[model samples]
Target: MRDPFAPDFFETPVAPEPPAPVEPVQPVPSFPHRPARSMAAAMLAAGLVVGSVAGGAVGAVLVSHRNTGTSPNAVATVAPGVGAPAASPGSFAAIYQQAKNGVVTINASTSSGGPRSFSQAEGSGIVVDTQGDILTNAHVISGANQIRVTFSDGRTTTGQVKGVDQSADLAVVKVSVSADQLHPLPLGNSDSLQVGDTALAIGSPFGLQGSFTAGIISGLNRGTTAPNGRALTGMIQTDAPINPGNSGGALLDGRGQLIGVNDSIQSPVEGNVGVGFAIPVNRAASLLPSLEKGVAIQHPWLGISGQTLTASTADQLGLSEKSGVLVVQVVPGGPSAKAGLRADGQASANDDVITAIDGHSITTIEELTQYLDTKNVGDRVTLSVTRNGQHISIGVTLGNFQAQPSATP
Candidate 1:
């Protein structure tokens, strides 16, 4: 998220520099010569940075120039920074130091086994309040009969699930760690994040506790398919390496404020591929109030199955607007159906479109989701629609998605 008053993100810390490049040596007239293969190998090794982050893939390659009999001591000029300059190391170190106490490594097992051989799994969490509430990924503790939380200070205690939203892939866990074992992490505004901004991820990636990686925000407002089979919108995309165990970890900004929750990674192999997605803190933050209250949180459903509008359809419908959602279907007896909203059909010939919601123009599902996410269940919204040859507005009360009947509606 960008700070309007400040040009640079004040929270994110800088990344550590790659190792300095090594130069191949030309034998001095009297010095004993090492084997050519050995010299080449040494040169190759020197060019690598060797960090665990997937962002370093390109940096791990060897870059060489043709031999022109230059002095062995020659050095080539590398770019000032790779991809994009990340936050400075000293700043990151401070952020990590400040937030480390708030993050805890989670261990879970089954009650059927004795303490020694209990089923064990590791994940990360962030302390959201002084009340010992920890926010983590639901998959981390799912199906575990018992949960054990190990704070950054190495203290272990049993934890209880406060509230779990499987659709959101988030679970709020509670451990009775007193104030002494905690430091609450500051949540930032993820809605303002833009591409090219710095992102710092800290977690126990691949079981390596307190591991840190830095990269740029490659994209924002991304649609993500959660491990729990829910489609999450408004996701933050980063180049930072987010391994399996890193789920629920903190995605910090330049100033070290928590901007996102590390949750999913895109990779062909099991290893990192530099493309990772995080749940925007703003999204998580919005839902947490109800979660902490121990109530089942509900989202306002539009009751319409729609796809993004295309240019051809926009022109055909005479609604050549940039912001509109093309309605594909309206579920029978659902809110949309009851509201008398029409979906694409032979009569209209798929010419009608939803141009706005409650006065807000929405061009894409991302915008539509954001509009819906801000509202609670039972809130009435007005949809501005175009049909045949006229524009009309319809009022519809958003329904709780969880309350929708599983049977055909």
Candidate 2:
């Protein structure tokens, strides 16, 4: 396990700044549940830099900080597809057999070779349409000179880039496979999924063709980093052992519905550590049209990175609400900056509190960005903030956020 003291992570817009030390506030029991998160950061399991990728090696990209702590359970491993298929069609065996046909192995290569004369990377994708439209992680095919998608039936076809939404770290690739050859995985309503629900992961983990793993939805609305150093919001957290090549694979529910896209794995060694994350299918479904249109998809950006405001932290700062996000840094010329938002103050006495958005109470930085997802670039919204003791409303038009600060957000 990496030191919990180390740092790297989700780009709330720009990368996060180290949180200031806070005086402990009394824990308010009735308040929303906010887990104490380590300020530590890690790289996405598959988002290696272009240079490292040029060597045909997979470097870490997503940050996985939490170690579920040791338990007294006996060690045991279950073989895939051991359960009764008829009783639970959504069983591990059923989901694997039913979905593996739609799951495709993606091999990407570039002639700009380094160690390997031809740099190559392998990942997974899901067939989303009969017309050859498939979905995978953007980083999987990032910078590929050629893409080849192979199905369980051993049918291979040239893959064309449809479009990539780097903010979500998702890409749609189109192939010329016949409709009969394509078995589209049904996209499930992620909103219906809850913690403890069955989650089946299918993809090419570590280039192993047609692999399957079963686990439960460990968490929801989880936040993680994308390939482009941006924050991916509302991610699904699972205990399934997703590995390096599992990026862009299918994270399905027991019913064999594609609920999430397997993307981030929790590992210090770029392997599986039992925890992994997936982009919710709802997020992918929302951006599918724009992706298919070959247009850039824009997720709203406030351009400032801050820490989650804990109830204890909020009370320690003398804030009224038991919940709210503390503003630590406001990027110059960002929507919040232009609206005159203040960064962390000389001490905790001065940190600006983002209390609400349009009236929706915000308690975490994830909630803030998730709310922004409902809006678009150029859409104006009123922000309710508490600076010092006074409450103020600031109207700001959100700006479109790309990779990094190329002239503000």
Candidate 3:
């Protein structure tokens, strides 16, 4: 199977033959102008694939690829009337009109060694403030040499990468433009989002600028992997039609508030199948302060891979705890290893089963990851473990996460 999150290259277009005689059909609306065939062919020849996933995990790909409160020193602002119960759901047209100006087209290019030879990638972005800070997916601008941002009014300007957090697949880009040219969207509370809530997506899918789609929130707290091979937890799943060139776009609520960032989709084919995921706006908001300053964000890491301890497995291993994470392997020199955490070796009975972290019960890997995300590097956390019928707490100082290389071809 092909890697689901692999970035697709623009293929050379073939000339169409004359159409057969048939009944006349209604005229279709025209789309934005695309790159010339010659330029597309050059990009294909360069073999550049943006937003490619690094692992063999299947069922997800980057669609290529915010809350309205004025976070202090942040680019995003809260909508005027978010968080309060709506009298009734507003129309999508109203939401579109309110958010269209904040959506933008991002064109990123990377040099391919030869003089003036480059490969280009296109995605979308959301304007956060008048200071020109726009939020987008890290994969959209990953390894890019030149970045161009186009506003809804058809004006294009150069963009600079302010900061990026690959572990979360989020980035901040800055452009120098007049205050009138920017329309900052209001940020909403993703925590306030419920399953079946209306979701509206606006972006440049398939290079069609100003495209819009609507759906409902399908699920929440979904787990997936980032482009950098790190686990992304607490994702918002939606039935919105997210597709190529939709990455880094805005996922808004019915009130025209920014709720999530369109990230990836789980589909058997290389297109949207009503299963899409978005990074919670709160996650981006948490990193905005550091992102605006061009500081590299470091995620707290616990270097161990494990499976959930089940009744059968626990019984077979003669373990007492039936619900917890079973430590399968611990990376050498990692925080867990340095803290003397034990994992299963040749003997399964000697394995350590983690039951809780900092007094909170953890029954599965997702719970553990969710807890870790709330922490920072160098923060000491206590892990309650059951080892060989003995319960003990181990103090481990968390470490920075290092991105694993992509295994996608």
* Best candidate, lDDT: 3
Candidate 1: regions farther than 4 A off: 1-89, 109-121, 225-231, 268-271, 312-323, 343-352, 388-390, 403-409
Tell me the TM-score of each prediction against the true structure.
Answer: 0.67, 0.74, 0.76
lDDT of each: 0.61, 0.65, 0.70
How many clashing pairs per prediction, in order?
11, 7, 15
| lDDT by residue (tens digit), candidate 3, 115-193 | 8665567778888766677888887888888888988887899999987777777777889898789887777778899
lDDT of 2 at 398: 90
Ranked candidates, highest TM-score first: 3, 2, 1
TM-score, prediction 1: 0.67
- Cα displacement (angstroms), candidate 2, residue 266, comes to 2.2
For candidate 1, give the lDDT of residue 33.
Answer: 24
lDDT score of model 3?
0.70
Compared to the true structure, candidate 3 yields what TM-score?
Answer: 0.76
Give per-residue CA lDDT, model 1, range 133-250, as digits (tens): 7787765666677787877766789999877765576777877866557667766667788898778888765445566888879988776543333335777888876765577788
- Decide which is better by lDDT, 1 or 3: 3
